[model samples]
Target: DQQVKQNSPSLSVQEGRISILNCDYTNSMFDYFLWYKKYPAEGPTFLISISSIKDKNEDGRFTVFLNKSAKHLSLHIVPSQPGDSAVYFCAAGEMNRDDKIIFGKGTRLHILP
Candidate 1:
């Protein structure tokens, strides 16, 4: 199965605090992992990514960690801002014949003022 699961559907965080989102996959062939953030009524935008061989990847306030053996990955946001309040999706994929991505259901993040 190509299911990517985000067990938590939502999270609430205070501004300037850290937010963590967790994901799990059952497919071992997935070599590339991605995190996407979405605002209301908008398509998700890519936030960060990591290859299966890498344990960690970071971009400014965002960090992504992957553990292939555990089939697990997480996204962390430090000092999360109000703008960061949105749905986060985790995706796992191998290069398709046409090279596209498959995404998870997503977790909504709510930043408290």
Candidate 2:
């Protein structure tokens, strides 16, 4: 079974608005959660992350919220732009484990003009 899951395969948002992406995990052992953005042929780049102890973490235009009880997390982007259009992936891993990170299938986000 997949540990990390992104229910939505794609999403669309208008430019200058807010875009929200969601993810869920089945593993409670995961202590670190991260969001990555990927373009077509390029590898994924880290966007934001949150530790298990933190309920929320925010960057300039991005914010991540973790709900441990619900085994869920979400990423929010404000003032969505065309440049932000890309595939978003959610990943989770254990702090103690140095192994591979579990990644969701991905959610393609389209920023409409």
Candidate 3:
């Protein structure tokens, strides 16, 4: 069973528009969730995170919302820019498991100029 999945492998949006990416998880035991942005040939950088106890977290242009009931989460970026084009990964971890994180394949975001 896939513990985490990003159904859309890629997306394209024009600059200055809203870009939304989605993720789903099957493991309810995952208590910590994070979004990471990655560039070509580079490792992912932590974007935002939400503990199971919380529903939403935001940092600047990035926002993440978690729906525990649906075991789903999403990332939204407003005024998307060309620089925002990159791969985004949704990761889940169990705090009790010592923060061992599991990642979705990734969503490649292409911001059209």
Candidate 4:
């Protein structure tokens, strides 16, 4: 069964605007959330992350918000740029439980000019 899910298979956002990618998880054991960005021919790279204890975390133009009650999380990229166009993978794991991380199918984000 899929523990994590990214409902939208693709998302298009205009450059210089805000891009929001959403994710949901059915496993309550997940206490850590992470966002990864992958390009055409490369492995996914760590973007941002958050813990269950925090509602939001921000780094540069990227931010991640986690809602434990809803088992939902989102990644927000402000002032979306052309370089931001990539497939974003949402991951969740239990920090204290194990090192296994469940990843979603990923959502392709296109930054349109």
Candidate 5:
């Protein structure tokens, strides 16, 4: 079974608004979580991350929140811009798994101008 899951295939948001992406995981061993943004014809780039010890992490307009007890996580982008449109992947890694990470299918976000 896929440990990480992004139930929403896509989402849309207006420019200068907020964008929220959700993710779920079945594996409790995951100690680290990350969000990556991908563009067409290019590889995914790391965005933000949070350790199990922390519930929230933020960088500028991007923020990530993790709920270990619920095995859920989310990414929030404030004042979304058109350039923020892309496919975002939620990834998780277990500390003892040799640093191998598991990624969700991905959720495509569209920013409307």
Candidate 6:
């Protein structure tokens, strides 16, 4: 079974608008969540991360929120720019357990002008 799931395969948002990417998980053992952004022909780079102890974590234009009860998380980008267009992957794993992190299929985000 897939532990991490990104229901939306793709998303489109106009420039200067907020883009929200949603994700869900089935594993309650996950104590950490991470978001990664990848451009074509390039490896994914870490965007932001959140611990189960916290509900939200922000880094500049990106923010990640975790809802433990709902087993859901989301990434919000304010003033989405064209450069922000990429595939975003939601990952989750237990920090103290193993090094294996489950990843979603990824959601392709298109930032329109």
User: Best candidate per TM-score, number?
Assistant: 6
**Sort order, TM-score high to low:** 6, 2, 4, 5, 3, 1
Clashing residue pairs in candidate 3 (N, C-alpha, C atoms within 3 angstroms) = none
lDDT of 2 by residue, 26-92 (tens): 9999999999999999999999999999999999999999999999999999989999999999999
Local distance difference test values of all predictions, in order: 0.92, 0.97, 0.94, 0.96, 0.96, 0.97
- For residue 49, model 2's alpha carbon misses the true position, in angstroms, by 0.9
- TM-score of structure candidate 3: 0.96
Q: What is the lDDT of residue 74 in candidate 1?
A: 99
In terms of TM-score, how similar is model 4 to the real structure? 0.97
Clashes of 6: 0
Model 2: per-residue Cα lDDT at residue 22 = 98
**Candidate numbers, best lDDT first, in rank order:** 6, 2, 5, 4, 3, 1
Candidate 6: tens digits of C-alpha lDDT, residues 1-113:
99999999999999999999999999999999999999999999999999999999999999999999999999999989999999999999998986789999999999999
Report RMSD for candidate 3. 0.9
**Count of steric clashes across candidates, in order:** 0, 0, 0, 0, 0, 0
What value of lDDT does candidate 6 attain over all alpha carbons? 0.97
Give the per-residue lDDT of model 3 (tens digit) for 8-74: 9999999999999999999989999999999999988989999999898888989899999999999
Task: Judge candidate 3 at residue 99 and give its lDDT.
Answer: 46
Per-residue lDDT value at 98 in model 2: 86
In candidate 4, which residue pairs get closer than 3 Å at backbone N, Cα or C atoms, i.e. clash? none
Using Cα atoms with residue i matched to residue i, what is each candidate's TM-score against the true structure? 0.93, 0.98, 0.96, 0.97, 0.97, 0.98
Better of 2 and 4 by lDDT: 2
Residue 44 CA displacement from its true place in model 1, Å = 1.1
8 Cα displacement, candidate 3 (Å): 0.4
